[model samples]
Target: MSTPFPSDETAKETPASVSKPIKSAENASLVDSSVALGFPEGGFTAWGTVLGACLIQFCGFGYTSAYGVFQDFYTQTYLTNSTPSAIAWIGSVNAFLVLSVGVVSGRMVDRGAFYPLMKIGCLLQCLFLFILSLAKPDGYYQIFLSQGVGFGIAIGLTNIPSIAIVSHHFQRCRAVAMGIVVAGSSLGAILHPVILNNLINRRLGFANGVRASATLNSGLLFIANLLMRTRIPPQLNAVSYTRILKNSSRDGAYICACVAMTAFEFGYFFEVFYLQLDSTLHGLSEGFSFYSLTILSFGSFIGRLTAGVVSAYVGIPNTVVGSLLISSAVIFAMIGLQSAVSVAVIAASYGLFSGNFIALMGPLVSYLTPENSHIGARMGIMFAISSVGSLLGAPICGAFLTSHYIWWKAAVFAGSVATGGCIALVFMQVILKMRQKASSVCSKEAGV
Candidate 1:
């Protein structure tokens, strides 16, 4: 919450180019207000923004988490002729856009476009869900276009801004607050699969089930629109995308974190998309497979809540690194899961660790941000870059799985990729510590 800029004396010593971002309207306002009065941290508007963000996460990423249910359903009945790899593209693309399109939306939020983006995103999300419900049982392209592309874009527009807006209201408790917000996705993931599973497979049928969800999402998004308010005004003269990219590329810690995120995402969804299918293939009861997603999401809810509280003590980077390591181990353990109890344990464990990554991602980006104004842009770029992994990971995992459904190869591939991510995060953390140490030594030598 301190001024995002150096003192005028310090500024004189700093190069003009180095201080350029400070002049931007967004950054300037942040510098002025924070220097004069600090963040609210917790108040009605602030908590309301958090509440709104939670709903946004619930509608956006939370619902996206339930795509595995859709994946299982489509593979078994709807898209019967499609290969698993082909079917996975639907979920991959949905996840990809959910993260990728943040580049545009995040930047827009920085420029004070949150309300417009949120409104349009909410409307688009509902519209697309309705369209998705209209698709025929065998209509692969229709489903792909409606649910995959349209819904993804809608959520992408909402997700990043909902996250970025929190920085406007809270700083000290940002991690915990964002953790609660991200946990909304876990809540959605928990409930949505149950709703979709029962409605589509048990009672209402696919189209009506989707319609029911769409109707529910519409109400939730509408409430979010009303409750969430941005405290920071837009930066009319925000930095250019090229400059944001150029600056981000030069930050070793940022680059390393982004790489870690990409690698983490590459392996993150195998369990989410494949758990039910795996359970069914292993001769588990339909009832168990149907609720496996719910169990995983329930673990995620606990994990996300735990992450914020834990990160307060361990630090965000350290917590993230630890989570990545455990998640990779869980993924590796999936090689030959057969017993229902064993599979259940692994699913829950994976969900717990993986949920940490989601909860901490925004805080991590905020920690790395050079200025408050860059929060949106930096998060956008990071998510956009990492989205490539989300885009490709599932289908690649599916391809690794053969016609005979050899699960170990995909497990190896996913776990190994996640391990690579853990290493990157470890490296990033070390670099951050070294920087902090060097800065501390300089401060001491300068004698304040």
Candidate 2:
């Protein structure tokens, strides 16, 4: 409950008996106490939470981000009997789970189960990673069970909460904090591949390398659990899912953002999943192609940070609309890349613009929310809807290629979808402005 305001008795007595400076001090104390009940905004503990959330992203989605390297290794060394498409299902399922599980995990966060969920999720990830270390060579089902399904579910449990937790500690600085947190995945993407490739290819074999990585991740996750803390008191009263959905459905801005998220995700993974192969097909060296994802990820790291800072000044909606348009243009430009330099430049450019959506999405959801308490459930619905695109987008892009890869077909398809999402973001922005204007007009007419 909010703190009570000063009573009318105090106001009456202040003018007659209280000194001016004393009255000012009383008002200031009240304001400070009220603000304390809400977001801390910035403090040592709040930033510590951001740091811990970053580690969660590093250990969770970071590994998933490097799945391209894993896929390449499996296709060549261990899982040769399985068709590339069949093996691709493993990564696809993992991606789907990472976002899809938010449907339940998000609600749990709202109900004040953040720590329990984090602990369980981190444990599950370590457990599955260890189990993944034991799978025999050419054992497709074993890998699928341990790495694909088991690990995916584990990451899913923590994925939404990592982003949602930031809402508790930050209000004004939230955009930048979320960006920094999500940027952890980019750093992980860059580093994990180097670790996996060197250990698997030159030093330890697959099983031992996975075990080593799992040990390292366990330590990091332990640190994250200790560092992260929830600031908001959870609502104990149960809220109906049907009521939340019904309210969200009536929101034009929320619906548009959902559609935009789904469409943006539909095309977002095309470069991430296929860039190395596409570079190789277009005549880039195998060594360069191998590092293509790393380069893209590095660009994304910078891009996410930049987007976060810029959005604070320009506003989140403006930043998102600009990012969508630029990203769509970059995807379209990919069709013309012929030389090694061109491929590298385009990959970096695409990463720079595309990274904006990742950083701003959490803040965008919070902006659209009518109540702070609804942030978790609304974010869950958004992620679950967008997971559809993540699950299917890559497979559909792969289908566009013949036995000999025709990269342009996929490029054209992906670009067009991103453009569609861009248009929707613009529409969402317009709707938001209209609603604000209408609300302002009503307030003025009511003489408030």
Candidate 3:
């Protein structure tokens, strides 16, 4: 981050408006230029933020991933009176708010409210978890409020910093950094469900299990809150947020990519929430059912890291297209899956593809953005726009499940919609590449 100004020669050669974007590539090269940015990239402090981001993301997304176990338990027992669709609303609302509330969080980030916002998020997340622990016996509304809305808002609040801090620190290794950060969520997905499953089965029981997780996450969140720092703080009031929104409209490929994100999210959580239930229904033993989710999470962990490495070489859009195609194929293949072993294998494949998809999102957004003028606003808008699918994806899947009493209907919905998403993504990639090629030809003609 050099000052958002062009040198005199460049200014003379290009219009002021054009100069800003001309430096975008150089500015992103936050590599070993300590004078431009306040700190050098890949330092101890930068890596510290990466670690913190990983912890925060792990807790935030881990909670979402672990909800499948909770969904199964509640439907079969505590919230048994509620329909599957209704009960699924808890996680849906959670995912919805986690994404939709990002507008406010993004603003807070631009205003340099990182620590305070994250602190609030930490408290609220832990408090809501404790509330959920107490509310299980009280009924659906209570669980919805605590685990869904409250916890979601909390995660949303903290999520800005978790994502933003990476940009503040790394540029050269950004994809790799983000991959590592997201892998935290994968790790959490594995640990939380396993922890909860053991506790619910032979250990502490449901109430204590939820409480234990809350306690554990409280500690982790606290550490992240301490270690995650916003490097090169944003200048408040500098970004014209409204203007950025308007500029975004000019980028058709970006808009199409966002749409693809929304569609993909529509089917994103289907297996995450249903695999264990499917296992149980298909007559797999209880312990194995829980372990299946762990397997998926583990596979996802590998996928995230591998995607990071691959995307670094292959480019984000290409990597995304590849992953989306694979994930779509896996989802469609689930329609006939019956045996626990087969389902488990499919789960791992889905995990690899979907994890890669998630891992590449940050890089994809970075590529689509023409300038880095308002990263926070861009992230918030993209998240809010894409959140609708997450809001309803699980509940709709639950409807398919409840209606059919089998996996076929749910599989159909998730798989078909996921394929639609892949098509949209492919079109987006084409549009983006075309735009880039046209820009390249224009630049060559100009011969600066």
- TM-score of every candidate relative to the true structure: 0.85, 0.81, 0.86
Query: How well does model 3 score by local distance difference test?
Result: 0.74
Using lDDT, rank the candidates from best to worst: 1, 2, 3
Determine which window of 10 residues in candidate 3 has minimal summed lDDT.
Answer: 1-10
Ranking by TM-score: 3, 1, 2
Candidate 2, 221-272: lDDT as tens digits: 9988888877554544545667778999999999998888887876777777
Q: State which candidate has the highest TM-score.
A: 3
lDDT of 1 by residue, 243-301 (tens): 87899988989998888888888777888888888888899988889889888888877
Between prediction 1 and prediction 3, which has the larger lDDT?
Answer: 1
For residue 429, what is the lDDT in candidate 3?
A: 75
> How well is each residue in 63-126 modelled by candidate 3, as lDDT tens digits?
7888889877887778878877887889888888887776777666655677778889899999
TM-score of 2: 0.81
As a whole number from 0 to 100, the lDDT of residue 28 in candidate 1 is: 44
The alpha-carbon lDDT assigned to residue 415 of candidate 3 equals 81
